[model samples]
Target: MASTSVSKKRKREAGDDAKASFVLSTQPKSQLGPVLANFPSVKPSKSTTFSCYQTGGNAKALGDADDAEFAELPTLIAGETDSVDFHSANQPTGCRYLVGVHDKKTGITTIRPAPVHTLARDVKALKSLEPIAVSVLQRLEARAALGETFGTKKAKLAIKAQERNKVDVSAMETVVDHLQESIQKSTQALPSKEEAQATADSTRLVPPYNAEATVPSEVYPLHNIIPEAEWRTLAATPFLVVGQMQRTPLLPFQRSQWINQHLHSICESSSPSKTNIKILLYISYMMFFRKFAIQSNLGKVVLEEKLASMSPVVADGLLSRFTESARSSSKPQFTSQKETLLLTHMFALCLRVDDYATDTELIARDLSQSTQSINTLFKSMGCQITKLTLTDLKRLGLPDGAAGTKRALLKVPLEFPKPRGKRRRK
Candidate 1:
């Protein structure tokens, strides 16, 4: 019985060893790769696009009553600067411009861009007409001077042309008077009559005006956005930007927004709406004499935001540009590189916008190379050097209310204190 049991155990052991050997021989070789089954290759459909929260989240107001697509983008959140995407190197420590949206709650002033469509005044269309209006004014003034020496016939013809183009003599006179005063102060020779004649293009259309006060629609127009009293005050004097100054007379970002809103109106309207042309000539004039600072960090931010939002192509182009540099390549997207790029681009664009500046590329090159300071750049462009007046600061988006008013007031001390020697420590 013992001998039979031993033989059975031996047979069992032999069978188990044989099975192990067979499994070892059947195993895949090192080069045979992974043994797990491969998933079927997923062929992405051409029409499909990937959407994420931060990317394609904003779709036009979702139709359903229950569907609440957030209407407002949250303002810069607390500790947003700590995000992995934020690169602080070259992030400017201070901004040149004083204009900012002051939050009364925390007393924090942020670069909170105001909607350009507000103020119900068509500053954009007006802005476009300002130069032509100026030209008509120049021709009128020239003819008027010549009419004094020559005859009223020439001046009459010029006035007729002004009337024909729909240019307002009142507004034109205000601007011209300011300009002449500026030229006189600078002691610069006034533009020659022949030069004015050479530059004049009578064919240009003068921007139209709104004679009728608009009734309140679903949206507020000029009526509510600007109080009648406030409008009257501003329109009364209309402190015109007559010449270039080292300081920016008008904010480029604001003007850009206005321009965009105006262009959009032109595209959307079957015809140019009165809304499009209402505040026309004034904006043109302000922009005409406003300084464009190449070295301004604020301008940098504006330019960057503009490029980023314009289209993916522009953003991609910017990325491609800075990515070449090792320093820029490693830094996060929201970095100084963008600021630098934007600042440089703004400077270039400003130079390009000046019809007077023939060598715009050279000027842009010098600025991009850091050979010119922002102050110097604008000064070279013949901008008048002036700080934001109390009126302008108040006109900009500051906090409201009597207490809010004084606290938010951006008044610089009217008088300077006499310099004193340093205090001697006891």
Candidate 2:
């Protein structure tokens, strides 16, 4: 009976050893390799009843082992337990673990191991690897949390910004239109007759006899000079031409004469002895021209014409005279043909629209009064005026009939006078 019992015990012991050995060897290489490498010297403790072992400050136990070789068994079991813990700990939580069976005949090696929270803690303690592990986990979590990719978020933001820009552009256009209308109403109320008579009297006191006194004695046909039928077309919205027409007399020629007279008077009165006269003249010219251009029908009509009609030669000559006057007046030199052209063009365009001349008589009257104000301002600055050429007039886009007449009067063939012989030494 004693021999049979010992035989039974040995058989059972062999079976358990076989099971543990098979588990350590037959498991997948990915699972077993790291486990064995990290805990190669694990050992079982003497006080433990089961196959208990310590590895990396962690302990694990298998089945009880009575009368076993504790001294050698501790080391063997420790090594085995560490191997199992390492391999099992690395497996995903959902993966099945093979903890029991030994042979292929049984085909039942798969067994679930108990939760190994301690091994997980040990893995976390590896600071060097923690970042990589955390990064992988975070990526997985993020993928699960956010269904959309980074590109989608960027596109959404870009679309929102574009929508905002469109709103701002529309608001700006509305504001511009409102300001333009207000200017028109204010310009209609200016005093017309008083301003025109004042301008005429001032001109009589200056050189280049006033056109009213010098023109052909035969009443220049004033009939179609400004067609009555064209009055509606010629008149602009009140404030639109205030700066260009200066004041309207319902006649384009009359407006032109008024501007010319005012400018001439300003120039004749300025003395050559004044210091910085050039600077004053330039400022005065700009202020007057800008004001008149803004109010004049001629100023408006000329601007509406195409660029081809603005004779460059005439424009150049007029600019040269403007510059010369500034220099002669002893003022700061004001040069730049481009700036002059741009200002002239803007003035012309402003007057061409009907909005600036809706009430012709009213606008003309306002311009006349404003001209006096403008002249007073210029006189205060001590500026002398210079005559602008027909080319300059053409740049303003005056009517073809007016432009042609002026061109005919101003045009002259270019010629060079013969050079005299050099003087002989005395």
Candidate 3:
């Protein structure tokens, strides 16, 4: 059995002759009594309960019960202050209706009919549209339910069958051809190894350091001398340090790669300048070929032999600058600490020890200076002219043959002396 409840919300306007508005709605039920009553044989299954509530201006609630029979609904007349709600129920199969006072003056009631709802029209429309066949729909449903696991057991066999019969190589051949063409074009556009080496050597004004020789124990005894900041600067042009002083042929890429890997830490720590690159090259040469120079001439080689054999470009530039600075009437002064240090290295190689005392005789002759000025030069470099003894020779790892002879040694310390300040005229 179907049951219904209708509620009316009444609102009164303020005034001695105020207007009132009421809305009648069947709560939780369709208004089907009038439509089903048209068929006299059909009887309503239940009755609808009606409730009226007044809000604003003497708010109160009024309620009543109505029969399921087709009784006429009451109309609201002007000056009829009482609000009533009427309801009825039949079969649960009709559209809803909204009843309102159409004209308060004439006491006429009106209803705006609700749209009819039925599934018959929807079913008819669905029948007109095309739909998947039952077999295809069932297949789609099965695939959705199975997800990724669908047909997985047969996947390998299907793949083998496709590879055996349905294989397509033409597209793959086209892609391979395109890739080959691209690679050929790329190779053609690049410079050959010989040509790249020639170009690099052309701009080179100085000889490259020998990479195979051991770095000097004094300069970089334990680890790299070049600091991280200098290494970053050197990285920009590793090719500059890529050739050999003896003109030994090397693989085009091997020298720089070895330098980056092995000698990166062995480079000198110095302030960056226009001469930084040259200074680094000087340090690298001394570090690598110091043993050769020491062994050959007992470390008494002349400037020409040292320059021509070791690094022509750097030696010539340094000597030119040194001679120019020495000729100035005022006492000699180095432009940079690096220049002074480089000179100290050059002189250190030539200093013959007469029992730990430096023999500056050859160096003094080469520079056209007296032994006293040569001594001053060594002193400026923080070296002490001392006598070389058997114990000292042993410490220096000198050969056994030199044990009987006396030699002069120059002691060069790690840190240089601070340059003396110029004295003011009194």
Candidate 4:
């Protein structure tokens, strides 16, 4: 009987040792308690747990409800609070950490911080997940599944792009048609007047001539030919022809004949009732005077001779006709014509008078004639010419006091005294 008791004692000690070993292996490190403690705060109070595998293999505890207390255990166990399964309570799902409690009373199975290696393994697997083309396709498929989200907007954008393309096509057609029409019209147009003139001026013509022709009879007649010695003898009297031409006396008459021809043309073309004859005569006389002025040393001698040679009645009649035209017309038909005539008359008078060198009698006379003509012209216009004073001259682009002085100066004859005898040494 004593041996038997000793054997029971030995058995008891072995059981105790087994319990100690289990406790040591299952005990959580203190560092894990804080981390695990945070889990309870996040645990859903109304969450349900269930053992998906077996019904009776789990114990359901109503969280925060008056439920029967369970005995504590030292070993890890699976339990359910409500329907949530604790079979893998210490394991982490993809997103949450699973925690458990260690019961200290019973040596039977109880929930505690069980092995979390499975939870860690699951988290690691998720971390290794990579995106692929298939993932993008799946996302697009999901978006398409939710068609009401974006499909309508994309369809509208496509419609707008098609409308814009149509507008561009229409505009291009219109532009091409316009360009072709313009090209056709421009090609059919005629050349301009200036272009025709340029073309005509660029053309060249050749004269008809033979390169090798004997002294042509028509060019060098036998009657005009003379011996070389006779020609040399005649060359010594070179001035004979020039002297004869100068002494012909009919040279002036010939020149006057040409002037008369032009004058007749002017008379034939002009109207008698319109004063055109007098106008033409004035132009002719002015032209002759200008030529004579340049040739006679600025109207020194030739102008005097020409004026003296003219019949007094004819000269007076011409002058009186010009003055009458100036008086009858409210407006001078040609101002340049009138000015030319007056200037020529003044030049002629200047050449006629030798006393003009000292005194301005001739100039004064011409000035009086001009003033009277102007006054009559203004009177025809029903305006007083004398009323156009220095003030009016300013309006005509002349300076103040210019009217009187310029008028006075223009009336003076342009003449210089002929030099007397040669100067003697002082």
Q: On TM-score, who's better, 2 or 4? A: 2
lDDT of candidates 1 onward, in order: 0.32, 0.33, 0.40, 0.35
lDDT of 2: 0.33
| Each prediction's TM-score versus the true structure | 0.16, 0.18, 0.21, 0.15
Winning model by lDDT: 3
- The whole-model C-alpha lDDT of candidate 1 against the native structure comes to 0.32
Q: Please write out the lDDT profile of model 1 over residues 1-426, one tens digit for every residue.
A: 465544445445433433211111222221111111111232223443322121144542222233222222211111111112111111122332222544444444443221111011122334446453457657766766666576667666875676678856687876897888987888665567656543442211111112132321211133322234323322211112122231122322334443333434443446543332323222332222122322332233454564332233333333443223346554323344433433333332332222112222233333344323443333322233343345544544333332222111111121112236799999
Query: What tens-digit string does per-residue lDDT give for candidate 2 at 181-202?
Result: 8888888887598686566544
- Give the poorly placed runs of model 1, Cα more than 4 Å off: 1-311, 322-338, 354-426
lDDT-wise, the better of 3 and 4 is 3
Error of 3 at 214 (Å): 18
**What's the TM for model 1?**
0.16
For model 2, the superposed segments whose C-alpha errors exceed 4 Å read 1-91, 101-110, 113-334, 337-350, 353-426
Root-mean-square deviation per candidate: 44.5, 27.4, 27.4, 33.0
Candidate 3 Cα deviation (angstroms), residue 7: 99
Model 2 error, position 123 (Å): 14
For candidate 3, the per-residue lDDT at 143 reads 58
